[model samples]
Target: MPKPVLIVGAGLSGAVIGRELAEAGHVVHIIDRRSHIAGNCHTARDEASGVMVHVYGPHIFHTNDDEVWRYVNRHMTFMPYVNRVKTTSAGQVYSLPVNLHTINQFFDRTFRPDEARDFIQSQSDPSIGEPVTFEDQALKFVGRELYEAFFEGYTRKQWGCSPADLPASILKRLPVRFSYDDNYFSHLYQGMPEHGYTEMVARILSHDNISIELERNFVRSDAGDFSHVFYSGPLDGYFDYELGRLGYRTLDFEEFQYDGDYQGCAVMNYADADVRYTRVTEHKHFSPWESHERSVCYREYSRACGPDDEPYYPIRLSGEQALLAQYVARARFEQGVTFVGRLGTYRYLDMDVTIREALDTARSCIRAFADGLPLPAFNIEP
Candidate 1:
């Protein structure tokens, strides 16, 4: 180790990796281009509303993994949060996830669970045995009307592509409940950090040896030090795009203020394809424990990431995967720098996966150092 390891980006992934390495008796330096830590998960009180608001968007922590649930619980006090989502489609407001209530209400029927299932099955076509596109998957699983009402337009709006063009696997988790459960996710544990995500991340970097430098930009040429480097920044940037750049989607949030309450729900998705925006997130509902007379809301718009936008979701198109493979090949030939995290690996990962991966990366680094083995370029494949 020549110098302390340099970890670029102070987001959840970078913070986790740095904390793990520092705890394992390795020096780490974290540098992020943003002025604040915690990346997009940053939350703070809106001075006017006096409510904890998610600056980027509403990021509810929900995961089924036991270890991941325990890992986050250790740092921050998590208050139970069930993301009850609704959608306004064709001038009708209904529960999301194609639940029994949504289906019964949307179709103006009072059918019981068994009757609802029979009715939906009757509407579904028996001809298509295998589904390929998002449209096919939704129709095959939840019937044509519910698919059009809930997913078809919404998927197109969110992904900026036709539902027919999207992969069927994307719609595999289309929640169709036999009961009337409106909570968006079926994860066992769901909550938001009591103090907020930023506080949790800052606590993670509270070690003496792990230093952080915000508002600083790092260049690829200077990645030479500390026996190895842990690169959590964008992988395409790391390799300087030896292949062409990957496709990504970034969200644009429009802020609005209101008195008393806003939508009365956390997220109100506009599922109709005609609607330009995806969903409007009311920040007040995110922190149910906190009472605020005024409220903060964000109208979220999804667009294809340009050269200048902050990439949120990796498109991971077939061509981009091939390009990523090329970058992976080039990265393997390089000396020290391990790619770990969402942007680094170019995969859409929630907080739990990032935390687990960072912990694993640190352990891998320790093993490589002890055995005198060459450091890995990437701990996880994109």
Candidate 2:
């Protein structure tokens, strides 16, 4: 008889992997430190407002992968959603991602697309060849005026660092559209789960062969009870931070209640250093399908992650990468355990990518089990 598999953390990674393995005839036991499922993407309805509030923050589902899109749809219904981000800079609202409309509004000019492109090109620093930092990238891409107006202060507040200190790749994530299209994401599919992420995750983990235990932490001794373990907890945490802690930025949300609409949008970025909070998220706006007289909003602030704080974004600066390399080397040697998910891999991952990796990992593990071989430490490199 095959021994049951143990999965740490009942988040997307663990749930998806457990479901896949259960269907393959393996008994799966999943556990999470938190009382509820759906790690960071947990969504719950406000009793008073009857609004589905994004507990951690807003998680807009946008994916180019057809398989991932279909997989999510099979479990829950997704309503059409297109994120149109807005930024407040110098007491004025501007369209985000520096689109054609934004350029015209910011500069107070009605230049055509070609003219706008040429004007921006002329404004950009011609001396810079191959940008290496966030500030440099912004200047090269949109010139100093736009960079200072939109990205400079926001990046500082969100990352807890100056734009000049951050890597150029960080700025590359944001797209600068030439047209009037204000859709924040360029993905083929974009939507929000009709019932919320928690309900969707519950459906994903509804396999008969799978069992879950929440508010339970994984111990080192527990590894011996199962044939193999899929650990989706923190990578540094697994080793008890033996090589010292890795750098991460954690978010502090100052939630406020309002009788009427708050921001009038799902997310609003404060592109000024004067504003202590990076962005404000009005939860009610997230689910336009549901109406709510009262709204729940969060003024999000980012800071250095402490020992007890829930780590949000991994600070992959040079020093952190050096420390991460050591942890990765250590994780590779662990027997009968595989590190998975955002925390385990120490990288920022979108929901679709996380599910995709989990599915692939389960298939790989099944092959290993059939061949009577040891389980892999990591299906994807950290």
Candidate 3:
């Protein structure tokens, strides 16, 4: 009999890969350090309010990939959700992404979309030829006033660094709209799972060939027991951080229950640096499909990740990238193991992209296994 494949971490990456491999006739064993599944996207019902709360943080699944969208829908019902974020800045409320409504409200003008665009163009600094830093990109695109109000304070609080120090790529992800389109994500399919992410993951791992164990940690020695190992833990931790610790920013959530509505929206950005926490998320707003008298909210604080903290976002600055390169080199030389997922690859990934990569990775692995070839250390570069 062939040995069962070992999958470390019962998150989306492991679950998707395991499901695909199981369907391909491979027995799979998946484990996670946490008591629950879905990793950071874990959601559970608030016992008192019966509101399905995002335990770690809010995760609204949005994707452009039809295959990925269809795959998730096969497991759980997803209700249509549009994330319209709001921001509190300079003692006034504003729509996020600096849309036409936000610009008009901020400047107290009734300019049309075209006039607004031309006005913004005049506000933008033309001196910046090729933007390098995040500050430069913001100023070149949206001008100082909008940058200061929207990106500056919020970015500093979220990353624990000035926008001037961050790369331009960071600010490029956010889009500035001339119209009143306040939807945070521009993806074609945007929704929340009906039951919750945990339930969806549970359904994905329900096949007879896949067995799961929670609250079980994966160490280096466990690799020998399986035919091949799909490791979704931190790449540095695989070697026990022998080289050095990579930099990461971890989140501290101040969870509180409210008798009624806390915030009108799912997410509210506190753009002022003095505000301390980056944003306050009202979990009830995340699932509009359900009704609840009480609400669950989290005041999210971002800080430098310590050894004991759960790493949220990887700080891929030059210094961290140097250390990551060392870890990547070591990972490449390691045998019989493949590193995958956010922590495994040291990259922040949206749920849709994670699932897409998992599906592709599984197909690649199945093909290699059939051809009696060695598996690559990573499906992507770290």
Query: Which predicted model would earn the best lDDT?
Result: 3
- How many backbone clashes are present in model 3? 0
For candidate 1, give the lDDT.
0.85
Which sequence of candidate numbers ranks them by TM-score, best first?
3, 2, 1
Clashing pairs in 2: none
Candidate 3 to truth, TM: 0.99
Candidate 3 off by > 4 Å: none
lDDT of 1 by residue, 1-382 (tens): 4478888889998888788878878888999999999988999888897888899888889888898788788888899899888899999999877789998889899989999888888888687789988888877877788787778888887888888888787777767887888888888999999989999999989998799888988887667645567777888887676677888889999999998788899999998888889999989899898888998999999998887889899877677778888888888887878888888888988887788888888888888877889877877766
Please give, for residues 1-382, the per-residue lDDT of candidate 3 as tens digits. Answer: 8999999999999999999999999999999999999999999998988889898888999999999999999999899999999999989999887899999999999999999999999999999998899999999999999999988999999899989999998877658889999998889999999999999999999999999999998988988999999999998999899999999999999999998998789999999989999999999898898889998889999999999999999989999999999999999999999999998999999999999999999999999999999999998877
- Which clashing pairs does model 3 show? none
Which segments of model 2 are wrong by more than 4 Å? none
Each model's TM-score, in the order given?
0.96, 0.99, 0.99
Better of 1 and 2 by lDDT: 2
Writing each residue's lDDT as its tens digit, candidate 2 over 1-382 gives 7779999998899999999999999999999999999999999998888889899989999999999999999999999998989999999999887899999999999989899999999999998898999999999978999999999999989888899999999877657777899989989999999999999999999999999999999887999999999999999999999899999999999988999998799999999999999999999888998888999999999999999999999989999999999999998889999999999999999999999999999999999899998887889998
Every candidate's CA RMSD: 1.4, 0.8, 0.8
Stretch of 10 with least lDDT, candidate 3: 169-178
